[model samples]
Structure formats: C-alpha cells, structure tokens
Target: MESPKRTRNGADVTNAAMLVDHHCHLDFPQFAEDLDGIIGRAKAAGVGTMVTISTRIRQFDRIRVIAETYKDVYCSVGTHPHNADEELDIPVEDIIRLAQHPKCVAIGEAGLDYYYQHSSAQGQAEGFRRHIRAARETGLPLEIHARDADEDTATILADEHAQGAFPAVLHCFTGGRDLAMRAVDLGLYVSFSGVVSFKKSEALRALAAELPLDRILVETDAPYLAPVPYRGKTNEPAYVVHTAAAVAEARGITLTELAAATTENFFRLYTKAQPPEELDPSLLKGAPPQ
Candidate 1:
C-alpha cells in the first residue's frame, strides 16, 4: 500500500484512484492523538476522500477546522437525532449559513432515532424537517441518520419531498427492504456501513445486492462500526476499503469497480465537494485496486 504524503501543516497530499468514506467523525476525541496518521493510513488503503459528519450544530466549528486542515476532507452541518432537543432553537437560516463554509458539503446526519430516543420524537422530527429544508434550499445533500424509526423517517421524507425535492442520502442504512426501496423511489441514495459486513447481516447483504447500483453508497461511520477484520477496533477512513470490498463481493463486482461506482455516486450527491486536484484520474477510470 502506498502511504500518503503530507505537507508541514499535515494536509494529505498523496492522490490515487480510491474509495470515499462518505460519513465519519474525524473530529471525535478518539482520533485526537493520531488524526494525521489516520488520514495517512486511509490514503494508504486507497480511500482518497472523507466527509467527517457533525453530530451537533454547535460543534460544527471543530468539524469545519478538521475539514479545512485536511485537503481531502470535507464536512456536514446539523444536529444529530440524539442532540436534536439541544439544538431545536437553531433556526433553518443558521444551518444554511453554516453550510456556506467551503469545506462543508452536506446538510445533516439528522433524522429519527427511536432506538435511542435521547431526544423527544417531536424534537427529532422538527430538527429533521429543518435540516431537510436546509438541504432543499442549499442544494446540498442531506445525510440522514435513521434507526428503528423507518416508518416515520420515510413518512417525513415523503411529506417534505412532496413540498420540494432535495438531494439527500440515508447514511448508515440499517432499515428494512421496504424503507430502502422507498428511499430509492423518492430519488434518495442509501449508504451502507460496516454493519453490512457482519456475519449476522445476511439480510442487509441481500438488500445491498438488490439496491440499484447508482443509488448504493458505502461508509464506515467510523470510530464506531469497524468491518469484519477490524470489528472490535476503532474504525477510521482506512477501514472503508473493507466495507467497499464487502459490498463489492456481495454485488459480485471487483473492488476497483465498487470504488469507481461509489466514488462517482458520492460526488454526484455531494456536488459541493470538489475532487482534489492531485487526484489520479485513472483511479476513477478503473485503475486496479490496491
């Protein structure tokens, strides 16, 4: 594997045809000690781009700084379902204004999480709708986080989308086939994470095989669900390759093919994010996987 080169300021400089970890939390304290090294290892593993997601609107500055520091990194802005109550007072205009940062490309990791229900269902729905409007207004993709609340998530998406179509993706999708198909039917993308690579995720893998190729995406949700080989360890962008490999195998395709397709899918949804100038075009042109 080729290691990433970096500048004195620690921005990744190496480029290759690689996969993208569409959702992660680089700003999390778990990466505080070795952030640069994590970026380097991800490059070595052929992950050329990463989007560190935001869990709280108030903490967006920390996430923004990480994106600004790493040339290949980008970020999103919004409150997670867990933090929805705390940021409920945050107006839609604030979310729009914050998303104007050059490195900020997506609108959220926002949606319903009945599984945890840290925030009231009403609070989560309100925040989700606000973020959806931000996405509709900003023309940036919304990174939705839904868990055990598929019905409500789908209902809100349908209701809000009926008002106006917006670019969005269901991040870390673990919902049933019905929700996945409904999301795709609504013209939204569905992203798979390390959870899809688990032994008990046979049903999830089957769904991955069934979803339309253009709407499928892969992520690590890292510093969280690490894939098989790194199952119990802290995940970083590097591990996205394993998730990609898993998705590719499940789809009966090569890693290079999966990399090309998902990376293309990523840029298509994240239109605000620009590819690194140093990126090797051949990677997207189907250069053999590392």
Candidate 2:
C-alpha cells in the first residue's frame, strides 16, 4: 500500500488503467476557455468517464450541454443548497421530468450545508426532500452534499428512505462516522474527494479505509479541492488520480485495484452511465504522449 508516484503533470506515472471522476463541474466558468482541452487532459490521465454535476435547476441547460458535447460525459440535475430557495417551486415531478434526459443520470447536488447557510436551512431541507422524492421516483441515484449538517442530512435520508428506497451517494463525503455508516446502512454509497489526500486528513482517510470497498466511490468535485501535490491549484477530473491513490493506500490496496473497485461501484450506483463492454483502445492512449 505504498503511495503511487505522480509525475509533475499529475499523471499516475506507474499506472495506465482508467478511472472515472463520477463527479465534476466542467460547466463552471473556470473551464469555459479550455473545457475541451481539459476533457482531453482527463482522458489522457485515464479518466474514462465523467459526470459534470448540476448545481442549479435553472442551469440544467448548461450542465446538459456539456454532457451532450462530450461522449464520455454525463450529468445530474438539481439545485445546490445555497440556491435551493430559488428553485423551491420546482416539484418532484419537474425534477423527474428533467432527469428523463438520456444524459441526466442522477439527481440533486442538494442537501443541507450549514457551513455556508447561503440559503435558509428550511429551504435546504425542503429542496432536499423534493430531490429525494425525485430520486426515488426516477430510480436515479441522489448526489448529496452534507456539510456541518450531518444529523439533519442523515435523518432526512433515513426518514425518506423508509417511505421508499432510493439509490444515493454521499458525494465528496466529509461527514462523521455516524452519518457515513448510516448511509451505508441505508444502501447508499460514500464517495471520497481530494480532501482525503490532505496531510491533516488522516482521520478522514482512516474512515474512508474502513468503509466497505464495494460501497465506496471516488471523485474530484472539480474545479475545486485539487489533491496535493496540486494543492492551491484549480482541481479537475485529471487530479482524481491523486485522491484515488490516497484512498487505495489507505485501504491497503494497489491503485489499480482501487480504480477497478471504485469504477465498478460508480456504475453500479449511477446505473445509467453504463461502461461499454469494450472501451475505445484509443482512450488508453492518454495525454497526447506528453
């Protein structure tokens, strides 16, 4: 379980196998100028598939366009807790309606975010419930973002799940062990982000390591939280390799094994983003030969 060496450019110099970012924000203005090049870089870095997450239902069109433009890209649709108030009128039916798109594979980057209280807690909770109902109705996975609101987040998920079961993943998980284990108890997946690679994140890494490998996934949450040695830089799908490596080492497994397990868990949860029986061999040819 030694750390995988990274080239200065962030490629896993030791591995050529593919990984999936599963979560990203390619539509953000940060990538507007070089989105294509960025996608190419991610491809070259062995990111075989990516889901550009939607943060606002009003911006679903923008998120969808990015997914539609990239063959390997898919997306989710829903409001972030910060903007939850803006789309409160939006009903479960509308969310399910929007999710019907072939490229929309999941729902809600939505959940409670007490840390940023940009929207009212009430608004966030209401929006979160609507998104949960939509996920349950649509049979699509729910992408959650719980920060400093773990108890409420867990309570809502459990309360709703009791009404009916729905697939979900605690995207970019930074919750307590109680919340994480509860999510696992409810048949949800827990995804780790670049934060797990931080030197101060030993506790997080240990918690991530202890989770069931089959119930765990990995992501970038780009363009944010770039893992070290790219710390202080804009994060992207290509940097997911760093987080993946950290997770693999924490789990006492090789990077290649973690890649296979996380990618499988991703598809099993997202369900709609089916990997081809055979990936294009050309995708294995990463980053334009550097």
Candidate 3:
C-alpha cells in the first residue's frame, strides 16, 4: 500500500504496488455526509486512484466536478441502461463532445441489463450502441454494465467491434464462461467486482484466474456490491482492499502483486487520468432519503 503518491491526472505513483478502483460510483447519495471520510479511508487503505463513473449523461457536469475536485478521482460520460429512456435523445456526438472534458476519462457504465429491465430492451440497446460509438469516436475506454443479457450483450459488442475496435471493460462481470471468452475475443478488458468475492463465485474466480493479466482490472462498483466481510452492507471505495484481496487470491498472487498489476491496468486504460486535486468532500450527490 505504501507507494509513490500521485494525482489522477496521470502522474506516476512512487509506489508501483498501489491499488486502483478502475470503477466506482461515489456520486450516489448513499455516501452523502461521509464522502470525505469514505475517501480518506480509501486513501489510507492504499487505493491510490478511482474512477467515479456516471450513470446519466445529463448529470455529467456534476460528475466532472467530482473528478476535478478530487486529486485521485476521474469520471466518465454515458447513461446507464436503467436510465436509457430518461436520456433517449442523448446522441453519440453529444457523448463524444462532453467526454472531451479533461476529467471525463471513459465512455460509460452503460450496457444491457435484462435482469432488471428497468428500461425497455430497445432503449437499452439503443443507448448501448450510442455509447459504443462515443467510445470509438473519443478513443476512451468503455465501462460496460451487462447483467443477465449475455446473448444480446455479446451480439452488440461483436457487431460494433466488427466495424471498428474500441477499448472497453466489462464492469461487474457476472455471466458465464462463454461470455467471458467472447468479451476477451473482442479485446475488451474484464473488471472483477465484489461479486467475484462471493461464496458461489468459484466459477468467476476461476475465470479471473485464467484471464490474461494484462486484460484484467479491479473495481469496487461501490455504494453497492460490497465483498464478503461487508456483503449486504453499504460499500464505499476504501473497502476495495477486500475485493482486491479476493482477486489476488484468485490469481494466486499476494495483495501486493494484485495492487501493482491492477494499478498498472487502470492507468493503461484510463490514460487520460493525471493527478487530481485533493479529495472532494462533495463528491457524492445529496444523501439518499431514508
């Protein structure tokens, strides 16, 4: 955990063994009053950097503020599949345009979500396509959020990548082995979250172990998906160490090695990230109403 400290704007860390949460959502109200404390714990826990991903393009300006204010945090642009209908008119050009912001480093937390189907399938698919185009046009990595729609997710990704390749990471992966290979085949990275730390996730841990080291990333997907010790409780970025520990165990490496490798993977993909400012107390939005 003790490494060279760096900002989010692509500064080299003195400690190559530092860990990074390639994806997190500190903007959610769940962390409200404690956002500063949450981030403090994360930094103290050795999480050197984090990407505070976005779910609604309309809320992106606020997302930018979080990234700009925090020295170790960056943000993304795009609508989540659940919010697809709310932002149906958001075009690929708009996404690409907004992504030009210095702190907007990735294209999405967008993809199919058949499990919930919160938005119509067509809307989700359309949004996914728009984000794919944005990712390609901006040359920013895509952060995908597929869940229980493996076939459609696989199909769309294959179709779009056929036209032109784009960097992408399958965030919070929870599908079968076939989908994993398909994602890998298209040269997209796979990010493991707390789900990989679950008791029945031996299958997922096996997948994590088998994947090429270069193509893997670790994430908290925080405010949700807390790993083993904290499962079913509210999660924040600091607990990324537990999930990182799970990933390291799956890969048969020490937490130190996992920290080093994933930190490298994060910077490689989030190339636009440099050192950020000091951590922002207002990173999350309003606290959720109880």
Candidate 4:
C-alpha cells in the first residue's frame, strides 16, 4: 500500500490537508524553458502534485512525456472543444489505448466553449460527447471545460451519466451555484482555478464557500489565469499558492487547512495520483515557509 503524504502543516492527506492542481496546461509553449524551476516552486508552495492537462489528443504523446519526466506530474488524454475540428477523428479506441499508460490520469480538458466559438458549436458538442463516452469507457475522470454554455453542458453531462457512471470534474469552474449543485448531485467534482481569486469573482468565491469540502478542488490552470498578486504576470504552476490562499479565505480557512482539504479532494476524485514523496510538517502546522 502507498503511504500517505504529510502536508506542509504536518497533517496527513486523508484529513482534508494537502493541495493538488487538478487542471493545468503545462504542455503549452509558454513553459518550454525553466519548467523544472516551475515544478520546484510549485512544490515549495504546497502544491505537491499537478495534472498537465492535454488539450489535443494528437499531442498526447508529448504530454505523456511530461508525466513520465516527473514523479508528481500526471496528464490527461483528449482534445479541447476549441480544437475539435483539428482532431475530429480521434477514435475512442485510440484515446482508451493511449490512456492505458499509468501516467495518463484523466480523459480531458474537453467540453463546450461558446465564449470563443473557435470551433462550431456542433463540433464542440460532438467532441464533448465523444470525450464523455471515453470517460465512461475508461473509468477515468472527465476534465470538463465549460464557458458560456451551462445549459448545454449540463444537458450533455446528464444524458451521459444515465448511460453509465463515471468520474468527472468541472475544471476551472466559474459557473453559477446551480451548476455547482447540479454537478455535485451528478457525483462530479468542481475544481476552481486562478480566476477564483479575481476581484470580480465574488459570486464564484461565494459558491466556493457554499460548496462542501469533499467536493471542492483547486487548480492553477497555469500559463493563464494567474491569481491576484501574481496577476498580470505570466502564470506558472508555482502561483497556485496564491490561488489556494484565495480559496482558503473564500471558504474561511487558513491556507494550510485549505491546502489539505483540496489535496485530499483531488486524490479522492482522481484516485490515481500517488502521494507526494515526503511529508512537510510545516504545512500541517499551518506555518509553511513563505
């Protein structure tokens, strides 16, 4: 059996301590250099593990290379709805086969994005259906990204859930409370990103506070949406610290308490991420080094 990791405050992972970045695109070109330093800083921030989400199934090999390169890193396997047209033929079998790799932890970063409409709404929806099916077939968590299409997203998820049960997560979740409650009802996890830290995101913060601890997760979604203080600068995995702090305050808890809770939530949802290498006592004591 795997040993549990100790958080920086000196708590075990099972007791609502330790933080995990459930969604991030670390494979983006923005981190081509100094990725090592990014990982190091993220670890120091109490973000012991991260998922470098895959936006294109065709490029999943490269993403897998990322997971293979680091102990704490893992990846997903699917195409973004924005790029649905590009990898339209990504077979479910191909995705399932590729996901067999131990490093591939989830099935997406995929879903609808009406806000951009980079791909036709139809193509996006079609791609979303395919990824959801993949999630059901592989028993891997679905990393859903919805923007300006809550109704459509919910409709699809509801339809798919009836087919069979599967683990799914709403990544970078900024939806209204209704969606949060619906996802929770559907046995899904909601992961907030740096956007949760924005001054204009009081509604989202309120939703975070309202959410049950077991269903809440936090992510950086890095190379974008860097939390405040680090806002306006290039976002990196390391900045997840600020995101966690914002989430902690939103939920009326200390950073260590928030970190521990979110971390436990991620592993509970993913069930594949191994524990962090060494337990940090400072994090458990809520006095992690600044």
List per-prediction Cα lDDT, in the order shown: 0.87, 0.86, 0.81, 0.80
- State the local distance difference test value for candidate 1: 0.87
lDDT of 1 at 108: 88
- What TM-score do all the candidates reach, one by one? 0.92, 0.92, 0.88, 0.89
Model 2 pairs in collision: 44-286, 44-287
Candidates' RMSD to native: 6.0, 5.5, 8.6, 6.7
> Candidate 1 has which clashing residue pairs, if any?
17-283
Which model is ahead, 2 or 3, in terms of lDDT? 2
lDDT of 4 by residue, 124-212 (tens): 98899888888888888999999898999989888888988778989899877887889899999888888888889999989988888
lDDT at 39 for candidate 2?
89
* Collision count for each candidate, in order: 1, 2, 16, 13
User: Where is model 3 more than 4 Å wrong at Cα?
Assistant: 1-16, 275-290
Which segments of model 4 are wrong by more than 4 Å? 1-17, 280-290
Candidate 1 lDDT, 1-290, residue by residue in tens:
33324322232334324789999999999999999899989877778789999999999999999999999999999999999999999999999999999999999889999998999999999999999999999999999999999899999999998999999999999999999999999999999998988989999999999999889899999899988767898888887877777787789876667778888788778887777665656534432232
lDDT of 3: 0.81
lDDT of 4 at 127: 90
- Candidate 3 residue 143 Cα shift, in angstroms, is 0.5
The sequence of per-residue lDDT tens digits that candidate 2 reaches over residues 1-290 is: 12335833344645745788988999999999988888888877778899999999988999899999988899999999999999998877889999999999999899999998999999999999999999999999999999999999989998998899999999999889999999999999999999998989998999989999889989999999989788888888888888888898888887887887777777777778857444544432221221
Error of 4 at 68 (Å): 0.7
Candidate 4 has its poorest 10 consecutive residues by lDDT at 1-10
As for lDDT, the candidate ahead, 1 or 2, is 1
Q: Any runs in candidate 1 off by more than 4 Å, and if so which?
A: 1-17, 278-290
